[model samples]
Every structure is written in structure tokens, then in C-alpha cells.
Target: MKKINLNSEIEELNPEELDHIEQALLSRAQTISKLAYAPYSNFNVGAAVLLENGEVLQSSNQENVSYPVGTCAERILLGYAGANYPNSTPVMLAIVAQRAGEETWASVSPCGMCRQAINETENRYQRPITILILCANGNVLRVKGISALLPLKFDDLNS
Candidate 1:
């Protein structure tokens, strides 16, 4: 089997030098954090995606009384993007999280489920999506594509 080292493919980008599409998503992600319904976790998360057509979409995590029902900000944004714009593919996504009532940013790693969801989209579209996660002190944890995070993933070839 051919092994793909995905991180090698992840392009490290300076926040200041991000492309216009990336900037749009980052701006929207920050704003969407305010709309997060994360009363349970108290850790609000926001995610934004830039579509091929240049439309920016964002969403915040929605918590539920039954914890199992809660959805992550990344999946929420992607789901909506898929539903609203069925024909379009997401080109990039940026994620950020904040403590309740705090403006300080924290790292937003993709949950296992979020990773799987992202994998599906990437596989479906056959396109690598750039993911940016804000880190402390103005640094960014950037992953160029979903493939690296979930290496040896199950795909059509496996079946």
C-alpha cells in the first residue's frame, strides 16, 4: 500500500499572508463564536469555510442536554455548507475556540467525529481542504489537508 504523509502536504501559512479566501473564513469564524450555543461545555467554538465560489460560511457549536447530540462547530459549518450549497465544494476551513466570556483564543483541534466528517467531504470532492486552527500568541496550527490527520483511513479502495 502506498502511504501518504499528509502533514508534509500541509502548507504552513502566515496569518498576515493568508490568501483572501482564508482571511474571509477567519473573520467569519471569529464572529460566529459569539453565536455559539455552548452552555454545557462553556468552551465555545467557531468554524468557517471558504467555498470555491468565494462565499464564506461559519457556524458555532450547538450543545444539547443529551451530550451525545451535540455537534462540533466544524461539522456544523460543513453540514450547512453541504446542505445550502450542494454543488459547491469547500476549499478551506478555519477553526477557533474561546473560553466562556474570554476573548483569548485557544487551539481548536478537530474532534474524532469532526475529523471523520471532514474526511468524507475531502474524499467526496476529491479535493484537499486547507484547515487553520488558531493557536496562542498569534500563531496558527495549520494543516494543509484532512488526509494527514487520519492516515490509513478507510475509503472506497478499501471496500
Candidate 2:
């Protein structure tokens, strides 16, 4: 038997190092996070997507009494983009999160379902979407594409 390893690169950067557009995206995500309806978990999450046509779409997580019925910020934003701007391709995505009563931001990554949704979005567009994750220490983690997060993702065509 042969052992194979999968690896992905993550670039750690300070907030100031990002370009203006990226900064704006992150800022929007942060702002939208405050609007999350997470009474159950108290874990507010926000996501912003930059479309090829220069449109930025943002969303926050919505939770319900039944946990499984809730939708994540990333999926919500992706769904909105797909429904409203079908022709535009999402070029970048920025995600941020924090606790309900916390004064400082927290580092978080997309859940498995959200990762699959992102991977599907990238596959549908046939383009890579740069992901920027806001870390707890005020730094940002950058990933080039969903492949970096879900290398062996499911492909309907292959199925």
C-alpha cells in the first residue's frame, strides 16, 4: 500500500497588508456579522463575496431552535449570489466571526457543509475564489481556492 499526503498553503498576513478591495470586503463582513441571528449558539459569523462584476455581497449566519435547520453565512451569501447574480462569478470570499458578547474577533473556518458549498460554487464558475479568513490575533489567513480546503471534494460528474 502507498501512503499519499495532501497539503495546502495558507498565507498569514496582517490586516494592513491586504489590498484596498480585500480590506473593504473584510470590513463589510465584520460589519454584517453584528446582524447575525445566532441566539442559540451566540457564535456570529459573516461572509462577503466579491463578484467578477465588482459587486460585493455579504451575509450573516441565521440560526434556529433546530440547529440543523440553520444556514451558514457562506452558504447564504453564495445562494444569494447564485440567485441574484447568475452571470457574475464570485472571485473572492472573506469570512469573519465572533462571540455574541466578545469584544474581539475570533478565528474560525467554514464548516464541512459550507466548504462543500464553496467548492461547488468554484466548480460551477470554473474559477478559483480567493478566501480570506480573519484570525483572532487580528491577522488574516489567505487561501487561493476551495481545493486548498477540500482537495478531494465530491464531483457530481464523477458520480
Per-residue lDDT of model 2, residues 1-159, tens digit only: 999999999899998899999999999999999999999999999999999999999999999899899999999999999999999999999999999999999999999999999998998899989999999999999999988888899868758
Error at 129, model 2, angstroms? 0.5
TM-score of each predicted structure versus truth: 0.87, 0.98
Candidate 2 residue runs with Cα over 4 Å from true position:
none
Task: Tell me how far the alpha carbon of residue 93 in candidate 1 is from the true structure, in angstroms, after superposition.
Answer: 0.6
Flag regions of model 1 displaced more than 4 Å: 1-14
Model 2 score (lDDT): 0.96
Task: Give the number of the best model, judged by TM-score.
Answer: 2
State model 1's lDDT.
0.84
State in Å the error of residue 69, model 1: 0.5
Give the alpha-carbon lDDT of every model: 0.84, 0.96
